[model samples]
Target: MADQDTDPRLRWLKPLVIGLSVVFVALIMALIVGLITGVPQRRAEAAKQTAKPVPANLSPAFAEQVLNLPRNSRVADVFASGERIIVRVRLADGTERLFALHSQTLQPIGQLTIQVEK
Candidate 1:
């Protein structure tokens, strides 16, 4: 008599447990897939932010400043990377000079002279 009373409850409990387990497994799989797909997208966004050049911080008067080079020097080539501009010059004495400047303000950052090793 008691066994017959509990039989209906057991019948409902088994299906309920199976349904809950399937839901739990589905949620876990979705979480794993989201993490796998989202990581590369986040890394690409971070790389784009870092690769962008920083804004120039200088007064308007600094913009008009001149970059002096040797007399008769001619610009051989120009290359730019990020916020820097590099000007390769052929000097009067047949040597090469590389001048690095800030791209936004055109302010001289530094210079490098290229000479053949003896």
Candidate 2:
């Protein structure tokens, strides 16, 4: 029994296996706790995202006049943000431009000229 207890073959392996098992169990516990706590927070964030409304500053005229797109330009897409609104327009010249407008005043705050590489 004493010789078996002191067996060199499994001396390192026993401690290594025990240490790995402890770490694995600890990680599993942590994952379970994270899932429990993270669900509500993620749901709340999703609610906030979906509940976001289109701002009053966003409109066709605002996109045309403020963004300086041609009269024939039309809104292709709209992106809402907390501080600003992004409007993607298809212009008469067959080019695409992205306009970032201020949320309150609906003024064009920034612009991006988009081009496709051949």
Candidate 3:
């Protein structure tokens, strides 16, 4: 009968329409949230890019004195935070040390040592 044919079409059509509607609504919500949160993050990143870069405070001699490592120890890498400068060094005996200092004063704050197996 005509009614049976129409009923079967509607059975698949209804679920398809509902699934599409849910997907569309979820996409719109995600877009809205991204716009709301992304604006501030983008502005903060732009501000950081425009800000002046901090010069590294550690020299090999300075690091050696502050860290109390061997005289032949050398600086490997330096990392800076707003409040502290991190100096990573390789000692003459191949031990690695990390020293944190005050960014402004270059005063020692913390130290870490990592021993490498020969």
Judged by TM-score, which candidate is best? 1
Candidate 2 vs. true structure, TM-score: 0.41
What Cα-based lDDT does every candidate model obtain? 0.87, 0.82, 0.82
Model 3 TM-score on a 0 to 1 scale? 0.42
Candidate 3: list runs displaced more than 4 Å. 1-69
lDDT string, candidate 1, 1-118, tens digits = 6557786748778678999999999999999999999999999999998785544555446647787989999999999997799999999888999999987678899999998776
Candidate 2 has which clashing residue pairs, if any? none
Which rank order by TM-score, best down to worst?
Answer: 1, 3, 2
| Candidate no. 1 TM-score | 0.49
User: What residue runs in model 2 are displaced by over 4 Å at the alpha carbon?
Assistant: 1-67
Name the candidate that leads on lDDT: 1
Q: What clash pairs does model 1 have?
A: none
Where is the poorest 10-residue window by lDDT in model 1? 52-61
Q: TM-score for each prediction?
A: 0.49, 0.41, 0.42
Q: What is the lDDT of residue 79 in candidate 2?
A: 97
Worst 10 residues of 2 by lDDT: 58-67
Greater lDDT among 1 and 3 belongs to 1
